[model samples]
Target: MDISKLKEMPYDELRVLYKQHLHSLNISKATINTASVDTFYLWRKDSKTLFWDTVLSNDFESEARSRLLKTLSEHSSGNVNALVSGYLSHLRKFRLYISSDSTWEQSETNQVKTEKNTNLRRTKKDIVIPSPTVEQVEFYLTKWDGLENYHLQEDALNKLFLELCPNNTDILDILLKASTLNDFYSTNIFSIYPVAKHIRSLNIDTRLDAGDVTLVRDIQHVTISNKKRSFYSFATKYCSHHNPLDYPIYDSYVDEVLRYFRNRDNFSDFQNDELKDYVRFKDILIDFRGFYGLGTYNLKQIDQYVWQLGKDYFPKNYGKKKRGDK
Candidate 1:
């Protein structure tokens, strides 16, 4: 297949082209598995140049290459020379196209330009909060109440903190679980223990104010390395449980739900950077509540609504079952 022609073709057309090529090569259906086809489809969707590059590389670890080799070997009926010659012929043509054409470079340049334009638009966009209906608010409130009660007992550290003061051990335990649970990236949980201890020492009255900038600042001060996300997750849950009406949890789910609602309602886009700043995030939540006349609902209730909403509408973002319950 011509690399330029493949690049010009739509994803659906590209898949058909690939399938037809496989058939022409006399590759058996048994060897050309769905996984191989799906992988190729994904690659084609991502970048035709990349897909061709990998296919031509003949890397054993590359799924496309492995599947192609398997198919060729099977068709050759144990004739090693025929299999080698057939594989080389296909590989040589693909290699020649990639080496000769500037398709890959051009594609990369276009991708860069597209990303630049997207960032430019994003910078100018203002986030808009959606207005919730009375019925929606009531449903969220009920779910929030139920979730709060359930998770309070489910999370060991949360339950302990509710009964006892914010001690180092309890605080560290919360940090540990928050860092490890459903975390794709591994965090050094023990490294952040000092940070948790400092937070406990500050005795930052969790009951003071929900949107306390000082509280976030204090927490940030103790953040040694890349533990900000883990620390904040633990802090927000602790604070929210202490004063549900004041503090709301901030996590990936909440962020996803907020964006989902905004997009669903065609509201303005909020920056992920803004959410990183705890103060800005809290202000956004407060403004969001006020905008929708959701003052009657507590912050924890709002958190519950966002979480449940994400789980229902954006299951891919939630990952594991019953994860955000706590």
Candidate 2:
């Protein structure tokens, strides 16, 4: 979209545009909603805080600036791929409303919003359980009980999903509905399928739970190219006894965004130090949410933004150099 048009559009208008665009691309409302929330946060983060602005400030003693300029200078004359990669790095890191680094002022500002009377953007609701079928619910519980992490890792994962997923009940109800629907594969069992596959692969004596099939399908569904590695390639080892499919996986987007926002060469570097600063990370999330006026968000949505940004920016550098090409 034209930068002016994008900036000019209101939140409601932006939502409509997102839905239309994603619809055209055959992306589901669930997926689009996830992406839309991400875009909203990105814009919000870029607009509100100096986290990003500080990086490109061009002042000496500005560590981010020195690193960024050094990077660009090195790649500018030598490699289109590297230069474009650097540019993409900055965009993902210092995204719409947040900064690469945190600040005391940013923390104060978000704290103020949470100061008791801060009007809620969306109603925070409790977990709403829909009555599917008595037999089905019992069976699901039984299956869940049989699972290794039924009360532990699996529970942790579910808590994360519930806290983050905006249309939480809908997805939950879908899981419950599918189990007894008996269509199995036809029930868009894609998401849960991978979890089941992973579980069975581990030689873990586990039965498929309510959302298991859909989870699995989601893992390898879009991954049409088996020859190409997954973004969650690191999980191969940690995921031995555990089901990697059960986890909501992120691609390079998460890494790219962190790299951009941190002005770091990579996410691994930032994690080493900044991970200690919980307040800083919370500020990052809050600034991002308000910048986009997105309803609710979690880390996965952040991943999607980075992924989208990568896909958005990479092609320009793929074939030729802008300054030296063709």
Candidate 3:
């Protein structure tokens, strides 16, 4: 049947034509009842009938009703009841399908919108920490060049340790290197006597191979002159300097930087236990680095980038020199 001609035909003529098509398909009220609802719809869809296609495609109840009412008003002089009884009887079941589909779509859409709003609200309440751009990282690395060679101090400490105790060069090297690299400023330098005595007392190798928790516990046990807070800084700096790809620095500046990145990237908060566990922390760092496509940069270079950014943006938090502070 020519659908364009049917659109132009009078309501009675169109209804007659529609009935003829249904008769050709041998689809009667008895046949429709025998077929399942889904099967009937599928058969109608395959029939290539314009009216069925148009009605079925209007998945929303209101839209389907509006379309039917508009068509009826235009072609049938607003004779809705007569049109439904004669030609539009099939649309009764179609209307129910439209209503169910519309309700399900609306419910799903509302649920998605609610979740998005909740996440947005939570994000707004969070403090956004800034991440370093590639340009910023390059600039920071240039700045790092001015700092004195850490190897020189490490060599001196190693030589001094060898003189003090020849047998325990390995353990002494770990302790002295870690203590020297600590960025925390102090008037009283770390004394070798107490550190050496403490190293002699420990059974395990004082290096990071002993695990971060054990190393930290041992450092805290031996730390004198109120240097407890710097224990992590010392140990992390030591491990990261030796194995930049494997270990990341975990100082206050780095902590602030990581928190900022977490908020910015929408990552979950790090638990205290996870952060304290060196292997777990390393895994998180590896994941984060991979996520940002920062695999090419070593942890030390990444550390410099974050440290400089923290100082620039969070001066008070990192104790960076303020505009007026000497």
Candidate 4:
């Protein structure tokens, strides 16, 4: 298979050649589209030597032949019944490769193009949740202050812990009742004592850090039940009641909103699991604030806004809908 001969062959002949090679490799599921065939012809005409150089540079002859056969597969439209489209796309990229003679794997222009395409793909199905504006954050905060029941419940918990359990001596009692109100059902009834004991041992009366949060959350295995459970959200909530500014609550609503904004606005780069880590989570929250020019608002306020935003838009409940609900 002298590919140099392909350099002079007409476009129709190149298409036939690609089809023949693809068939010879037992790869005939896809109908090679005309556009890909045209690109292959142009690539061969303009840079067959460069293309061959890339293919034959492989150490093993079998590797080189495999590369060549891969390059010969045509791009497909509609359903991809074979692995041909990827190889054809690579051949398409070869035109850009030789045109720039870039030192890097991709030229700057190609890099931009690739990124643009990538972002488009990432957000194709994503409902673009609007990034928070100063007005929007303020609006949500105002909404938060208006929720009377929320304030009532939060105020009662604050008073109880600050005054009654100031040294957390009665933390076990506070937790037993508070768990129900705060919806810490995931933390077992019997585990409350152990979790309370762990918190008291930390003596986070004045300050709390990432390590403290991790310790409090990981009191699962030490519990009476001895089951593997994590109270990550519960830990954040408890620490937050003690020091709201230091510890941001990790509610599902807050988590969903952070992920949505992170995806939509590129405010921060973090793995989904990293949000479970207190320090990284707080840093990401700070980055979100800075990115959206909401620096005037504190983490607590930002938490309120994002949590409400997510509740309104990304509700997890799939329960039966009301008559007029969307």
Give the winner by TM-score.
Answer: 4
lDDT of each residue in 14-66, candidate 1, tens digit only: 55644543343333342233222444432533566655556555562355545
Task: Give candidate 4 misplaced runs (Cα > 4 Å).
Answer: 1-126, 171-191, 209-222, 318-326
Q: What does candidate 4 score on TM?
A: 0.53
Which segments of candidate 3 are over 4 A away from where they belong? Answer: 1-135, 146-193, 203-230, 241-245, 317-326
Best prediction by lDDT: 4
Q: Judged by TM-score relative to the true structure, which candidate is superior, 2 or 3?
A: 3
lDDT of 1 at 256: 71
lDDT of each: 0.51, 0.34, 0.46, 0.54
Candidate 2 lDDT, 12-76, residue by residue in tens? 77557655544433323444444454333323434423323433345613444444445434433
Specify the poorest-scoring 10-residue window by lDDT in model 4.
Answer: 75-84
Q: Candidate 4 on 1-326: residue-level lDDT in tens?
A: 23455456665676564554333222113222322353353245346554445533535344433454444333221112122333344453433433443322446787666556544542213233433667568777898789886767668767765555545445675565446434422332444665666655655554443325454354322344566556666666666666667666776667777887666546688999998776778888888877766777788888878877766655554752211111
What's each prediction's TM-score?
0.46, 0.23, 0.43, 0.53
Clashing pairs in 3: none
lDDT of 3 by residue, 147-173 (tens): 455335435544543444334346565
Query: What would the TM-score be for candidate 2 when compared with the true structure?
Result: 0.23
